[model samples]
Every structure is written in structure tokens, then in C-alpha cells.
Target: MADAPTDITLHQKSKILEVVFEDGATYNLPLEYLRVYSPSAEVRGHGGPMQLVTGKKDVGVEQIDPVGNYAIQLHFDDGHNTGIFSWDTLRELGENYEANWADYLKRLEDAGATREKLWH
Candidate 1:
């Protein structure tokens, strides 16, 4: 069980979701990061290796819908609304942001992919 967020703000201009936990820990999670690392079964398979999501560098968060008192569904501009980020998952994502992001980057590199797609 994780402490609920004391505050949650969507910085529309910056495309970042700022969350402050009860323990005085705050995280400015980027929309792209959240979109790529979505906890949805689409991104994370039911089992085995998770899928790699790409071409979401300019994606925007459309809205946040509360799911009872346990999680929140992030509606993305890409029309993705399957992931429900629970309090504990959010805390883990925030706490392990650096490591997770590094791993994602390395995976992208290994796959010969770029954060953003090539422009025509």
C-alpha cells in the first residue's frame, strides 16, 4: 500500500504531470514517459517481455479520470486510455524514474529506434 498523492497538477504548457506524495516526494512525470511506459496490458503484456512503444514524443495527456479510490486512468492524445495507474505503481514509477528511463533508452537504442520518428 502506498500513500495517496497530496497534490496532483497537470502542467498543460509543459506537458508534465506533477504529483506530490505524502512523504514529501514530488515527481514531474513527462507525458511521453507515461505514455511509453504505460502499465496497460497493451504495453506490458499479460506475461513475458513487455512491448516497446514508440512515436509518442509529441503526445499529450488529454485528461485524468479517477478510478474509484485506487487508481487513475490517463487519457492520452493518442487515444490510449487502457492503463490505470495505481497509487503504488505511481509511487514506484516516480521513485525509479531514473533507472526506468535509462532502461527504456537503452532498449530503444538496442532496437535501433529513436525517441521521435523521422520527419518527412
Candidate 2:
């Protein structure tokens, strides 16, 4: 069984979600990170390659809806609410934050994408 979240708090000013688990684990996840790494099919891709989501540095979670007993549905200010974040997924994201963020930055660099820069 996975460690259930004991407390979940959203820091709107900082755009961070603080999650404390029953196993004495705590994670402060950035909203942008969660948005980009969303488990939704649109971001994860069906069976091809994972899509590189850009221009979400200012995205924030407007609401968090509980999904049964295992996951959460994050409603983003950018109108993205498709991802259902499970407890395991949240834990994994928190655990691998550093490496995953670094990898994301590298991918963005490779794709000539910027978290802030947008060109029309």
C-alpha cells in the first residue's frame, strides 16, 4: 500500500503544493512542474513520445479535487484539468524532482523551447 497524504496545502503566492504523507515524507511541488509533467494523455502522449509542454512558468493550480481515494484532479488556471495525479505518481514526482526537472530543462533546450519565452 502507498503512503496516504496526511496534509495537502497549496501556497498560492509561491505556486507550490506541499504534501505530507503518512510515512513522514513531505514534498513541496512546484505548480509549473506538476503542470508540465502531468499524467494526462495530452502531455504523456498515447503511445508515441511525451509532448514537451512549454510556456507554463506562471501556471498555477486553481483547485484540487480529490479522486476517489487514490488521486487528485488539478484544475490549472490555464484551463488544463485533464491530469489525474495518483498518490504513487505524486510521490514519484516528488522523489525524482531534481533529476526530472533537470531532464525537462535539457529537453526544452534541445527543442528550442523556453518556459517563459513565447513567439507568435
Candidate 3:
């Protein structure tokens, strides 16, 4: 079964997405990191090869709008915001944060990429 988020909040100033689960676990996800890992075809691609997004260290969320009751539409400062982040997806992200983040860091290290700001 998939975990569900109990509450969700966006901290614009800090560029962080906070999610609270029913188990009382809270996760703080950075906007830049989210943007880089967007599920949209523009970022993730469709059927063919996956495109790796680079040089997104300074990217931030320009706006976040509700997409019905299922998801949220995030607008990025870099003009890329087709990703509809669903509650289920957010919960999954929260659950797999450590593994996903570690993999991201490893990819960055392998590509010689560094984030401009630190995410906590």
C-alpha cells in the first residue's frame, strides 16, 4: 500500500515543500530538487530516452496553484512547470527521500554538478 500525506504546505521564501504524513512524519523537499525531478514529459520524457536536466541549481518555484483536489501545478522560475504533483506522489517522495536524494547526489557527483544552495 502507498502512504498518504496528511498535510501539505509550500514555503515560498525557503523554496521548500513540506508534507506531513498520518504517522506524523514531516518532510521538507526543496523546490529546485523537485523541479529537477519533475514527472512531466518535458523533464522525464515519454517513451524514448530520458533526458537528464542539468544546470538547475538556482531554479525556484515561481508559483504553485491547485490542480483540482488531486494535485498541484507548480510553475518554475525557469519557465518549466508542466508537472502535476499528486498527493500520492508527494507521499511517495517523502517515503523515498533518502534513497532518491542519495541517488541524485551520486548522479550530480558523477556529472560534476553542484547545487547553488543547500537544502535542509
Each model's number of backbone clashes? 0, 0, 0
Among all candidates shown, the one with the greatest TM-score: 2
What TM-score would candidate 3 get against the native? Answer: 0.80
Cα error of candidate 2 at position 32, Å? 0.3
lDDT of 3 by residue, 1-120 (tens): 335467778888887889887888888988877887787888778876545676677787878888777777889988988998887777777678789778878887887877654456
Question: How much is the lDDT of residue 2 in candidate 2?
Answer: 68
Higher-ranked by TM-score: 1 or 3: 1
Candidate-wise lDDT, in order: 0.89, 0.94, 0.77
- Can you give the TM-score per candidate against the true fold? 0.94, 0.96, 0.80
Tens digit of per-residue lDDT, candidate 1, span 9-44:
989889998989988999999888898889999999
- Output the TM-score of candidate 1: 0.94
Once fitted onto the true fold, the runs of candidate 1 whose alpha carbons sit more than 4 angstroms away are: 118-120
Clashing pairs in 2: none
Candidate 2 lDDT, 1-120, residue by residue in tens: 466799889999999999889889999999999999999999999998999999999999889999999989999999999999999999999999999999999999999899993658
Best by lDDT: 2
| Stretches of candidate 2 exceeding 4 Å from the true structure | 117-120
